[model samples]
Target: MAIKMGTGDLAKYPFLNEAGDYLRQSGFDWEELDRPDTREILERAEERLRTAVAGNVYEKLDRYETEILTFVVTLIMVKSIGLDPVLKKYALAEARRAEKFLSEDLRRQSDAQRRALFIKIFEDLFGLKIDVTEDGRLFKVRVTDYLRRSSHFHEQEWKMINRLVQAGQVFLDADETVRLIRNELAILIINKVRGMSLPTLPNSLVERVEQMRAELTPRFEYRTQVVTEYPPCIKHALDVMNRGENLPHSARLMLATYMLAIGKPVDTIVEIFKNAPDFNERITRYQVEHLAGSKGSRTKYSVPSCEKLRAENLCFATAECDGIVNPLQFGKKRANKK
Candidate 1:
C-alpha cells in the first residue's frame, strides 16, 4: 500500500494535510503493510478503535504507522454516515496511529507543564463548579449535567490529583474517576469551595480535535475499581456475583456482612445482588437489613473467620493472606500497624 499527497491529493480528498504530512515524514514499513490476510488486518483495525476509546490508543500503535490519522478522521466521518462495522474497524486503526503521535508530543513536555495542560483540558471540557458565596447561580443544574455525562478521566490518570488531596494516601473501592467526580461534588459538602482544578490536554491535541470539527464531523457496564484489599472469600463472592452466578446462602451472608462492615449503604449492597438470577429487591432488602441489625436480635453480623470460610469451602487464600485468621484482617495487616 502507498500513500499519495500534494495538490492532486488535496483535490481528491480534503483532510488536515499538515497533520498528514507530519505522519508521512515519520514513515512506515511497506512489507508489513502489504498483508495477504485482509480479514486479520480488518479485525485488528477494529480492535484498535475499541482499544483507543478505552484509552489504550498509544499502546496499540506501537507497530502500525499508516492507519493513525486516518482512523481519527474516519471515526468522526462515520458518526455522520451510519457506521458500517467495516468502516469502524479501519477508523479505529487510524485513531491508534494519531494518538501515538499525540502521546509522543505530550511525553516531551516537562511533568508540570504536561499536568497543567491536562488540567486546562478537563476544565474546558467540564466547567468549574461555582461557589455559593461567589454570587452564586444555577450550579446544581450544571453539576447534575456533568455527572450525567461520561468523562474522559480514567483511574490511571488520577495519580497526580490523588496526591493533591493529602500527602498520605487512602484507598477506596471505587474508580478514580468516581473519586474525582466526588471531589468536584465536595463543594456541595464543604460549601466553601469555588471549583475543582483538573488537568487538561495540550493545545496541540485540542487543536487537532477542533480541526476535525471544522473540516468534517463525526462523533459500563459497571467499571468499579478492583478492590485488591478484599479477602479471597469476598473477592470470590464478588466475582461470582459479577458473572451472574448464584452465591450460596452462607456465601451471600458473608458478602453482606463484609460489605456492611466496610460501610456500604444498604441500598448499594442491594444493587450488588441485583445481578443474581433470582434477584428480588424486596427479599434482598429484607435480608440485607436483617443482617445489618434492623431486625430480630438487632445485632449486626460479621464476616466469617478464615478457618470458618475454609470449612465452608469459600476460602481461597492468596500469599498475602497467610497467617491471617479473620477475613477482615486480610488487607489491614499494615494499616493495623499504623
Candidate 2:
C-alpha cells in the first residue's frame, strides 16, 4: 500500500483565494506576490476564526483569551513591519505572546466581531487603556461590548497596527510586553470588580507574595532576623516554672495570674493555655487583680508590710516564702523557639 501525502503546486486552483479577497477588501497595498510568512500568518488566523465559528451560537464564554488573539495580531504585524534578527538563532518558535479578553452571546458575534478583534489587537497589545482622551471629552469604550460587537475595529483597518506591536516584541524583551499590554486591562475590570472573587490572601499578602516569590524564584537572595516575643508578665510566670525544673497545669494558672496582674489582655492570657487543663481568662483575671493584704488584718501603714516581711510569719508574701504561688508554678518553663 502506498501512503498519501498532501503536496501540490497550487498556483492554479478551482476556487479563488479567500485570504487574498479579504486583504483586498480591507484595502491592504501588497506586492500582489505571495510571501511565505504572510501566507502562514493569515492562514493560521483564519483557522482560529473558523474554530470560533463552529462553537454554539448562543454560548457565553468568560475565558481569558488575550494570548490567542495577540498571537494572531503579532503574525500580521510581523509581515507588515519585517523581521528583527536581534533574537538569537536558537530562540523558540515565536518571540511574543498575545491575547484578547471578551465575553458575549456567540449568536450575535458575526455583526461586531471584526471591530472587537481589532480594538483588542491594538489596545491590549500596545498597553493602551480604554479611557477618555487627555481632553476628558472622549467616552471610554467598554472592552466587553467592543469584543462582543467587534466595535473597535473595522474590516481591514487593524492590519497595520497589529504589525507594529509584533515587530517591537520580536526585537525587545518579550516580558516587557506585559507592561505595555496590561494598561487597558484595568478598564475592563472596573465594571466587574464589585462582583469579583479572588483567591485567599494573607494578612501581609503583598509582602508575603513577594517573600515567596523571592525564595522560590531563580536568582533571588534571602535573609533572616530574630524577634523577641516575651513580655514582662509572661517572663515572670515563665521564670517561676523554670526555677521548679518542671511546670505543671496548676503552675500554669500561676503564670496566667502573673500575666493578668501585669495587665496582659485576657485573650493573651488565654493563649498561654497550651497545657492549662482548667484555664479560664475570667478566673485568672480575678485571681491576679488583688493580692491578699496581711491576711485580712494588716494594712500598709499599720504593720511592717514589705520591710518586716518574715518568711514564716507572713501569710501574704512571695510563694518561695510558703504563700503558694498559685499551684501550677511547679515545673520548668517550656521553651519556645522561632
Name the best candidate (by TM-score). 1
For model 1, the local distance difference test gives 0.47
lDDT of 2 by residue, 142-181 (tens): 4332333322222332223432222122211222222233
Over all chains combined, what TM-score does candidate 2 have?
0.15
Cα-based lDDT for every prediction = 0.47, 0.29
* lDDT digits (tens) for residues 228-283 of candidate 1: 66987888888877764447677898889989988999998987875553455677
In model 1, how large is the Cα lDDT of residue 255?
Answer: 89
The per-residue C-alpha lDDT of model 1 at residue 310 equals: 74
Residue 326 in candidate 2, Cα distance off native in Å: 89
Q: Which stretches of candidate 2 lie over 4 Å from their true place?
A: 1-111, 123-202, 217-338
Residues forming the 10-long window of minimal summed lDDT in candidate 1: 130-139
lDDT of 2 at 307: 24
Q: At residue 13, give the lDDT of candidate 1.
A: 21
lDDT of 1 at 161: 39
